[model samples]
Target: MDTRDLARIDLNLLLSLQVLLEEGSVSRAADRLNITQPAMSKTLLRLRDVFADPLFTRSGRGIQPTPRANELRGELQELLGGIDRLVKGEAFSPADYDGEITLALSEYIGVALLPPLIQRLHDLAPRLSIRTITRIENQLEQLAQGNLDFAIQIAQTTYPPAYRWQTLGSSPPAILVREGHPLTEGEVSWDRLASYPLIRLYISDLDHLEIARSSEAFIRARSPQQGSLETSHLLTALEVLRSTDYFLPGPAYLVRNEQATRGIAALPVPEGASYELQYRLVAHERTAHSALHNWLWEQILDTLRGLRVRTIHRG
Candidate 1:
């Protein structure tokens, strides 16, 4: 039916149609719906008028469904089932869910968080699927549109009123280099680091113009390291480091585990460096009230706690 026809249809007619098709007898359907036989007959007549088809006909003392009525039965059953669930006001149970949850994660947070998060999901909700997106051009917009359930990243810019975020942890920058790189063995001085070309990982959602101005200032006052290969992907930067003497400075938690796995190591930042970064767990205001999202967010916080502890130990 067209939208206007659908708008004219009554919701009670759908329920009555479901009961009539299941029972196959007008009298019995009325009993099931706690209404009189005449009232149920009136509803069936209204259904036939709306559908422009005789939905049921005589079959001895019972009723026989017309082909059109049979055609609508399966679709009506599913629609009513959704309505039932919505009205039930039931608490979400992960074990019972068999749907996919989508979230956005930047490269570093994905590396640090996905392994443990996937493991936990497997243990608790094996059938539930998780789809993570890394190439997000607009995180908050995606979240508000229900395309993302959660996102973990550094909030360098102010968020709009529709977002709810929690700080994961904050740390100063650390330099990452290949295992046998010269900077790893010697005293890592700003001048020594500046002597080699650097791989710059571009994160932080702050305006790019502001980042450029700040970067220029840092280069002038601190070191004249040319950001030879700048990218949003940390793994790409790490791959560049494997064959060359280039190193990148970033938050420790994002690189610590990847460093050990890839034969890379961290060098202490110069003692006077003042740059600090903080990661946050972000969700849309719409999803912040969801029990399932809240549960997952709490697990993320717990994971970050362990990350911070291990980073201290590694230092």
Candidate 2:
């Protein structure tokens, strides 16, 4: 806390602490830092003195961080990272930057957005590698901890203060049936829809649908059971619809191009029905200032906007 305490702290020691806290083994930490075991032990002793806490203690084969150490671990990584960035003092150039960017997005967005996004990256940042993962639990926590560069999913509620979200577009749910289906030729009404078996594509990644809640309630009241065919896979729902009288009620634009030829055509929802979902791009507050990240974010928004325009024209 004092100048003398600050003078005793070394950046290298801080990094060593990060590795030690992560690895929980002095030898392993030393190997990671490419330092001798004795040197690592000495650095740990210095870190203990500087922090005035026994940072780690023996726990079976490996060491466990104390409560104080556990608390310091998070702050230490961020602190060391900022210091490292400050020391490098290099501008971010997307074309020349060669690092892997991890993104967390759902299978739905992966199908709709990945192709265009990856193509854009290839054109602009040839050296940049993208690794996409499915949206997992504790998504915001993962994003804030730098596990994900960006997440493409539906945000049903407000995110924590540390996360930033950008609305892409909202798509009202539509009834998808075969090209020559009765609903396609007639006035599609909730009464008519309830007369046939429904194919529901359940998006497990969503906590709950923003606009689909009423639709869900109405369906439950009508059927009081799961859809005749229920699945999380969009293709599966479409496939079932292609072969059966089952009608799919989900995102309006899910069926496109080649799949549209699979006897798939969208039917407008009945009057006063509010089944829709708003997709958005969520990122950590820390990434907002990075030029490369911001550019990528803008490209995503632009791609989604174009898709919305095309959908509107087609509608």
Candidate 3:
């Protein structure tokens, strides 16, 4: 059929056409439906003329829907719901969401931050479906393309103008050592730390030059060692440290959990030798106001506040 024909037809006819395509045979369709066989046949003919495609045809004992009919099924289902919502003025509530949401986050944040928030969301909105994609490269592009609703990352000193950011929390990096490591025994001096092997956690394109520069300055002033064994993940670094006398420097939250610290201890770095890492929630400003986006943003902030309170009380 021509585009002009579709424009002249009533849209409600499309729903009847869709139902006829599903049932295939006119008699079975009429039986399953409340309509008569002749009425169903009339609707099928109308659909054939409207789309200018034989949407279905007779086979041996039963009829079969053609490729076009098969393809229209999914689109029709969504369109029908959209039409219903528009006609009735449907509203969305966080507590009653039955839609799916996608989140992009780094491995560290996904492991240390999202669990409790997701659990709480599950309790509140059991029908909501959430999918998490990790270690997303080019996070801003993903957000702009609607592939990701939100992201969590270490806030950098500079960012593109398209992104809106909110600080979640910040904490200083800490040195982690095995329970019986020599450094944890007594007064661990800077020179004494350098005497043992060091395991470092490597983030994507993260500037380890700063660490190298600081180590050189320390060696120049206090004669400390300046060598490291690098690993890609924090958990692997912790594992290496546990087996050998190696030391690892990473965010405290990752190791603060019971599994990582069962036989590990966080050591105090020498005065003036630490860096602060700040966590930030980022999204495309244009899409940040969507209900799902805002809900995720609030969930993150709430989880961070609870974590802060727990940390303070524990201390």
Candidate 4:
């Protein structure tokens, strides 16, 4: 039925039905709802007519809901709860939100960020479930279509204004190699790096990702297909970096976690090869006035704000 059909429904009747279901006695239901028993009986008749089911049947001593009422019991409570929220508007506490949000980000960032992010959110909004996916066909488009709630991506130069974003931090280049690799022993340069293979960051859905390194400086290739080994899992990438001579190119802080990278090391980008990236928290403009969306965005921004990505100056 159209929403316009809802105008015919007296919302009070649903409340009465709920009370009746809970009380199981007409007199008790009426007393609980502050109405006369006859009035309550009449309301129950109206509800019956509306639902086309004798919502309750006489049991041995009292009353019991029919199969239809039994079904509507759960659905009706949900419907009434929605109505309550709608009437109350956006004044809500995070602890009250029982919704889920899907976030997209490269696993490289997720490794360093997700633990704290999830912990903070769970502390503040225990009822909120955050689901993360590492690969997506397109980040912004997914936010626009409501398929994704938020994304932590390498910043781009400009957005169409239909999207909202926050610059989380810088993501300067970090070349990851196993502890015993030759690059770790000698001066690490792009020329010396050429001897061993590079492990490219693989987010298979994106053909290329353009990263806005900084306000004035720009880098040509952010998502260049540069490596022989392409894997999206951070742990897997770290394992490969531990076992092989191949190097992984990524945000510096990703490999800086000592516990996670016991046998891996971060090399500053060579002077001539330096490029930078900034992490941006992106959401669609559709969520502009959504208190919940904004609240979650703020939580995310707070969770990932202080990454001090180091940079090397080039002549």
Off by over 4 Å in 4: 1-90, 204-208, 211-227, 306-315
Instruction: Tell me the tens digit of each residue's lDDT in model 4 across 1-315.
Output: 698878879999999998888899998998998889899989989999999999998887678999999999998899989989888786868988999999999887887788888889889999999889887877778889999988888766567879978888775777788887888777776566666766667653333445423211212322243446667788887888888888777777665677888888888766655666767888999988888998888877766553333222210
List candidate 2 stretches off by more than 4 Å: 1-89, 218-227, 255-261, 306-315
Error (Å) of candidate 1 at residue 98 is: 3.2
C-alpha lDDT of residue 128 in model 2: 92
Higher-ranked by TM-score: 3 or 4: 4
Each candidate's TM vs. the true structure?
Answer: 0.66, 0.63, 0.62, 0.66
The candidate, 3 or 4, that scores higher on lDDT is 4
Per-candidate Cα lDDT values, in order, are 0.77, 0.77, 0.72, 0.77
Say which prediction, candidate 1 or candidate 2, comes out ahead on TM-score: 1
- Residue 38, model 2: Cα distance from true site in angstroms: 40
Model 4 CA lDDT for position 163: 90
TM-score rank, highest first? 1, 4, 2, 3
Which window of 10 residues has the lowest lDDT sum in candidate 2? 217-226
lDDT, residue 159, candidate 1? 76
Question: Candidate 3: where is the Cα deviation over 4 Å?
Answer: 6-90, 185-194, 205-233, 270-272
